[model samples]
Target: MVYQRARDQAELSAIQEAYHLVSKRMEGVPGLLGNELLRSAHDPSGLVVMSRWSDLAAFQAWEQGSEHRADTAPLRPYQDTRMEIPFGVYEVDAAY
Candidate 1:
């Protein structure tokens, strides 16, 4: 997942909406999983986005996929991002 910053409330909301809708399109991909978005309590402009995929390849494929490209419709109108940072990637080693 990654954390991105927006310039203001409007931009932050747009990013959140975009991410939410985009994930739905990613549902059937191989190794597909789920994700979450968080706004910093201290700074609401800070967004934390975490996405889980079947694997790195799956994630990469999604990034390069055409469907993923189309999902940008919600964000194209708003150039609302300030900065983005990769928080971390966790591998599913063991789970129930």
Candidate 2:
């Protein structure tokens, strides 16, 4: 997951637009399944971006790629200034 806290409504709009562009880029990525952007009800500026991929290797490849860097550059400012922005990778140990 990725978290964002924009400085204001304008920044939030920009962040959303940047995420839209990044999501578009992810659409054709080799093993990317899909992704969702969720906004916090309590804080309009807070956002959570979650993505799914075919495997850890696939995700890692994308994470380390130049294309990913280019795609997410627009979000760097907000990401850098945000508080409590947590990132992680988890094993899908169980499924319904």
Candidate 3:
């Protein structure tokens, strides 16, 4: 079970919009396992995503797909206010 985490900030409304897009559209895409959007209780502007894919390739394909691009278009306007500060990603090794 490999996971990818993307940390970004957006208005509650935009987060809601993006959330729907992923739930509806991403599920149909190949290689998607599941994903969720998490908001910081301390900071509304802080948004974190926990996504699982069949594997890294599947995740990369989704990232490069048009569905991801188009769905995220709505987030452009608020880039300044609702953007992640600096994020890090770590790999999870495969289990035996």
Candidate 4:
């Protein structure tokens, strides 16, 4: 997951735009299942990005690729923290 906080409204707009652009580019990428962009209800400036891939190798390859780096460059400054999981620590035992 990716987490970021914008300093102001303008920064938030930029952040959203950047993520949209990147998400658009991610379309048709092999092994990529889907992605979601979310904002915190309590903290409007906070954001979370989640991406689903077919497997760990697919995610790793994309993470190390130039496109991912380029796409995420604008977001580096606004990022407060990030968490990357290599394996499924928690599984969906029940999804209704």
In TM-score terms, which candidate is top?
2
How many clashes would you count in candidate 1?
1
- After best superposition, candidate 1 residue 47: deviation in angstroms? 0.3
Candidate 3: tens digits of C-alpha lDDT, residues 1-96: 111223453356665685676567555678877767666677655565666677788777877877776755544343433334433444577767
Mind giving the per-residue lDDT tens digits that candidate 4 earns over 5-78?
A: 77799988988888888788789888889877788899887787777788778878887887877766776777
Quote each prediction's TM-score: 0.61, 0.83, 0.60, 0.75
Alpha carbon deviation, residue 46, candidate 3 (Å): 0.9
Give per-residue CA lDDT, model 2, range 1-96, as digits (tens): 777777788988988898888888667898889988788999877787888899999999999988887877776666734555466577699999
What lDDT tens digits, residue by residue, belong to model 1 across residues 23-84? 77666766667777777899866676677776888877777887765864654444324544
Best by lDDT: 2
Q: Report clash pairs, candidate 2.
A: none
Off by over 4 Å in 4: 81-96
- Model 4 misses residue 78 by how many Å? 1.7
Model 2 superposed RMSD (Cα): 1.9
Model 1 per-residue lDDT at 82: 54
